[model samples]
Target: MMTDAGEQLEVQLDDCPPGRETFNDPLQEDASGPDSHLSSALRELEEPLLLLADVALAPPCGRAVFYSCPEAERVERSLQSVQLQLHFLLSKADDLHDCLLGGQGHVEREALAAAISSLLYTCQPYFNHLESTARSTMAQYTHVPADMCSTLLDFSQQLCDKLEQLVLTYASYGLLSLNEAEPDSASHFCVGQTQLGQLKLTIFRYCQPTPYLSRANTQLYKRMRWNVERVRDQQQTEEEDGDDEEETFTDYYFLCYEDIPNPHAEANEDSEGVSDGSVVRMWSIGQWVQANPDPSTEDIWDWILCEVPQGGYNRLLFLGHDEPSSRSATDYLQQLLLSCCTD
Candidate 1:
C-alpha cells in the first residue's frame, strides 16, 4: 500500500532490473500478537519511510549502511554502493528538473555533495581509488549544473590532500627507521653514471669492512655496461679480414676493489718503494677469457682467485667470494673473504 510518489521514489532507488527484489525481509514476523503485527507493519513501511526522508536526508539511509559495515573492506564496498545510488538519484533528479520542472538541474546539488562527503569520510582506506573514481565520474558529466560540478571538484581535491598527507607519513617513518639502522652507511655508498662512447656505464663504490684483520677497510667497486659487437662472419674473406660481420649484444659486469695497503711496508724500508706510500693498490677479481672472438656465441668472462705476488706476503689475501646472498654489499664482501679462507 504505497502512494504514487512513494512508488516513483522506490523505482528510482531500485538500481536492479525488473522483477528482482531489491531488499530482503530480515525480520519475519508472526501474526499471533499485536506486537508482531506492529513489527510487520513497520517492516513493510520501511521503503516508503525512506522515500519520505530522502528529500531531507539526501542519501536516505546511507549513514546507517556505512556505520553497520564492520570491516574496512566492507565499509569501502558499502560506500561504493551508496555512491552509485546517489549518482543514479542525481541523474533522475536532473531529468525531472529539466523535463517536468523546466528549470536548471540545481535541486540535487545538496544531495550530491552530502553523498560525496560521506563517501570521502567513510572510505578512508580506499582514498587513492576514491580520488580516481571521483575524477573519472566527474569527467563523464558534460552538462552537470555548475554547483554540482564545483562540489565534485572540491571533494576530489580533498581526497588528493588526504592521500598526499598519508604518503608523507609513510615516507617519514621509513626514513626514520633507515637512519636508526645505519647512521653512517650512506656516506660510504656512492653511485655515478658516465657515457663510455655511445654506451652508458654505471659505477658503484662502497666501503667494505674487514673486522677480523688489522687491515680492516677496503673500497669495493662495481662497473656495469652493455656492449654490442660482431659475433660472426658469413664469408671466409670477411672472417680473415674482419670485414662483414654479424652483430650481437650482451651485458658486461665487472667486479673489482681497492687492495688494502701493505701495513708492514712502513716497518720494512727495503720493501720496493714501500715507505713512499705513493703506490696505488688495485685488485681485479674477475678475468676475461677470449674463448671466441664472436661476442654472441661465447662466455667471455671468468671468475678466479688471483695469487698475491711473492715476497710481499704479510698475510695471503683471503677474499670471500662466496657466502649466503644478501642485499648488503659490505656483508657480501665479508662473506666472500670467509669463503676464500675456508676453500
Candidate 2:
C-alpha cells in the first residue's frame, strides 16, 4: 500500500539522526531565529522538487531500443523542457530562502503556490505522453523479454505517482491550488472517444498466447453489445461432475460488425471499394484443460466455438467500460491506430 505524502514527509523530517539536522524544526525552533521556521518550510518544499528532477533524469529500465523510436525523441525534448523549468524553480527557491534569511522583501504565498501549480500543470502532459509511448512500445514487441517490459511499465507508473504525490503535498500546504488547474487534455480526448477502448483491446490481444493478426487488414467493430448468462446445471453436469463447490459455467454473447477485405484485390492497392459488409460472431469458453504436459497442476481458459459470418471473418474485442453506444467505431479505431504510430 502507498503511504500518504504528508505523513511520509513528516516521517522523513522526524527520522533525522542526532547532529545531522537538515530542515529546521518548524514547531520547536524560535520564530525570531536567524533561519526562521518559514525557511525550513521552503526547504521542505524544495526537497520533493529535487527528487522529481532526479527521477525525470534517471534512465528508463528497459532496452535502449525504445529510445531510438521517434516518439522517444519528442518525450526527450519534453523532459528537457521540464528540467529547464525545474532549474528556474530551484533558483527561485534559493532566492526566496536568501530573502527570508535577510529579512528582505516578502514573497507572496499565493504567488509561489501559483508558480508551483503552473509548473506541475505544464509537466503533466509530457509524463503522460511518456507513459503511453512506453505501454504502446511494450505492446508492439512480442519477442521482448517479459521482465524488461514489466520494468519499463513499472517505472512509468512510479514516475507518475511521484508527480501526483508532489502536487498533493504542495496543495496540502496551501502552496498550490488544485481546483484552478486545468483538466488533462489527453485524458479528455481518450474519454470523449472510443480510442481508449481500442487501446485496451490492442493490449489484451498482444498479451494473448496466440500470434497477433495483421492490424492493417483488420477492421474494428464500433457498435458491439455483450450479454452474459450462467450455463444450465444440466449442461455443467454433462460436461463434468466435480467436487469443487465453486465450479460453475457461464456463456458470453457478442454482437459484432467488422469489415473484411476482398481476397481478389490487387496487392499494394487500396481495397476500400472492394471490402465486404459487417459480420457478427458469437464466442464461448470451452471446458478447462491441462495447460502443460508437466506433472504440476495448471489450467487455462480456452474458447470453445468462435462462429464467424458466412462471408466474413470475426474479430474478438475487449471494449472499454461505460463507452458511449453511439460513437463511430471506424473513426475511433483509425484515430487509435494513428496515435500508436505518432506516439
Candidate 3:
C-alpha cells in the first residue's frame, strides 16, 4: 500500500534539518534550573510511552488474532481489519490501567465510557455493513451458534443506547446524519443503472471512505465540498461572541452531491447498470496535491502539469468494477461535472 513516493517521504522524516535539535524555549530554561525539568519530564514520559508502545506493537493474540479462514481473501481481510481496528483501541484501554494505577485509572473511566458510547452511536452504518459482511462469511463457509451475531449486535446497540444517555450531560458534537434527507435539500441521485423509477442516493453513511470495494459489486462513492451546506450549532453558545459564532457556522459545505445525470443520459448510461454521480472526481489521488481550496483555472498548476488547472478535489471515492458484487455500493461528484479535462 505504501507507494514509492510515500516510502521516500518516510525516509525524509528521519533526516531532520541540520540545526533543528539545538533549538529550545528560553522561557522553559528560565522556569527550571540550568538542566531544566525537561530531563525529568522526558524521563517520566518515556515509561508511559514505552508501555503504550509495547501494548500496541506486541504480537496479536486471543480474539484479536487473524483467523486462517477459507478462501475469499477479500472478505477475510475486511473482517480482519475491523477486528484489528477494535483490538488496537482496546489495547489503548488496557494500557491505561497498566500505566495509570487505581485512582488515576478510574478518573479516565468517564471519558473512555463516553468515547466508547459515542463511537457505537456514531458508527451504526459501520456496524450494519460489518454485520452483513460477517453474516455472509458465516453463512457461506461457516456458522455461529444460536445466531449469536444478531444477539451480540442487539446487545451492543442497547449498551450504546445507555451510553448515549450519559453523553447528554456533556457538550457533544453529535455527528451529522448526512444520509438522511434534509427538509430543503434539493440534491438527490440514484445508484446501479440510472432508472426513471430505480433510485438510491444514500452515501456518507460510512464515517470515511471504505476500502476493498472490489470484493463486492460495482460500486461508487464521491464527495464534493464547495460553498455548500452550512450547518449551525444546535445548542446556542453562551459565550459573549455567540452571535458571531452562529453567523460563522451558518454556511454549509455539502460534502457529496450524488447522481450527476449521465453526460449522455439521453444515450441511456444507466441501462448498462451503474451509478452516475455528478461531483468532480479525482483523475488520480495520493500522487497529486492542490493547494488552493477554491476552484480556479488560473493557477501555478497549469505550468507544472502542462494541463489547464481545474480545481481542488480532496474527496475519496471507491469506484467499483463494471459488474455487481455480492453486495452493492450506494454512494459521489458535483460542480460543473467530473472530468479529466479540469484536473
Candidate 4:
C-alpha cells in the first residue's frame, strides 16, 4: 500500500542502527515538525560538520583549524599573546648568555658589538648601561688589538645612549631610585690588568624608609656599658652558685700566632726563643658602643670597603645592626682603613 518514496523511507528505517529504531520513534513524524529529533541529531553533529568544512577550505600544503565561536576565538588570541611574550624572554636570555660567553672567548670588539646590537632590542628596554658595560669589559683587556679599540669605543657610546633610554623608561615605571647618571664605564678600568669585574646596575621599584639610627649620648653609652657589666656579673653569680658552667660569647678579634723556629732553643736575650714575629691587635664592639653611642651619617655600604690593618684579615663588627647611618660608624671604618694603610 506504500508509495515509492514511502517504500524507500521504510527500507532506511529497517536499516537504522539498533536502539535508534526510527520505526516506532515517537519523534519520527516530528523530524520536519516541532521538537524534531532530526534537528537534535544535526545540532550534535555540528562540530564534525565544521571540521569537514575546514578541511575543504584548507590549502594543499597544510591545514589550519579555527573556531567560529566568539569565546573560543578570544581565548585563542590570549594564548597567542602569552606565547609571544614568553618567546621574547627566551630570546633575551639567550642573547645575554651569548654575551657572557663571548667575553670569555676573547672575541674581537666588532664581533661583540654585532652580537650586542642584535640583542639590544631587549636589553636596551630594561637596562641603561648594558652596552657601555659590555664595551668597557671588552676594552679592559690589554691584549685587545689596537684596530678594534676605536670600534669598541663607538659601540660603547651607542650603548650608553641605549642605556639612557632604558633607564628613562624604567624611571617612568617608578623603578629607579636615583635620577643621576653613573660614572662612565671607563672607570672600571682603574684596576688595569686585573680580570674585568662585573657590576649589576640595580633598580628598586619602591622607595623604602631608612633604618632607625641609634643616637649617641653619654647616658646611652653608660647604659650599654652597664649592660655589658650586668652580663658579666650574671655569669659570675651563676659560677659562684655552681649552677652553670662559664658560657662563651662571640667577639670580633684579630688573632696573630708566632711560629717558633726552634722549640728546644733556650730562652736568651737576643734569641727570644728563636721565633717568627707575629702580632695581632684585638678590637672589641663594646669599646665602639662606649665611645660613640651614635655614629655619623654616611653611605654605610661604601664604608665596609675600608682596608684592614697589618696586611692581615680584618674583623668588622655588625652589632646586630645590619644597617648603619651613624657618624661614629663611618669614623670607625675610616679608622680601620687608616690603620691598615699605616701598618
Which candidate wins on TM-score?
Answer: 2
Residue pairs in steric clash, candidate 4? 128-163, 216-293, 216-294, 295-326, 295-327, 295-328, 296-326, 296-327, 296-328
RMSD of 1: 28.5
Better of 1 and 4 by lDDT: 1
Residues 1-343, candidate 2, lDDT per residue (tens digit)? 0123334433433343322134332111111112332233223333332232223332455644333455445444544443443344334334433433354223544434333323332223333333333333333433333343344344434433344444455446554443311231111011111113223221100001111112223343322221122324555665676533433332222223333444554554336633232222322111112222322423322222312111223333333333322123322343444564479
RMSD of every prediction: 28.5, 24.7, 22.3, 33.1
Task: Give a tens-digit lDDT track for model 3, residues 1-343.
Answer: 1133223322332232322243232111011111342223222212321222122222334333232344235433433444443343233334323332342544454444333322332233233333332232223222332233444334333333332233332213231222212431111211111111111111122222222121322133322112212234435553544464443221112233223344543433366665455323422111113333333555666557643322233434434323211122221222112232256
Any idea what lDDT model 2 has?
0.32
Clashing residue pairs for model 1: 319-337, 320-336, 320-337, 321-336
TM-score against truth, every candidate: 0.18, 0.25, 0.19, 0.18
lDDT of 1 by residue, 1-343 (tens): 3234334444433332222133221111110111232223223323321221222212243333222234334434434443443343344434423332232344443233222222222222122222222222222322222333344334433433332233233224331111212421211111212222223322222223222112323254322111212233358647667767544333333244444565545554545644555334553333222322333433434212212111111222333443211112222332333464368
lDDT of 4: 0.28
Q: Judge candidate 3 at residue 271 and give its lDDT.
A: 65
Query: Tens digits of per-residue lDDT for model 4 on 49-70?
Result: 1222222232234444344577
- Candidate 2 residue runs with Cα over 4 Å from true position: 1-108, 141-144, 177-343
Q: Which segments of model 3 are wrong by more than 4 Å?
A: 1-71, 92-101, 105-117, 122-125, 132-343
Among residues 3 or more apart in sequence or in different chains, the pairs in candidate 2 whose N, CA or C atoms overlap within 3 Å are none
lDDT for model 1: 0.30
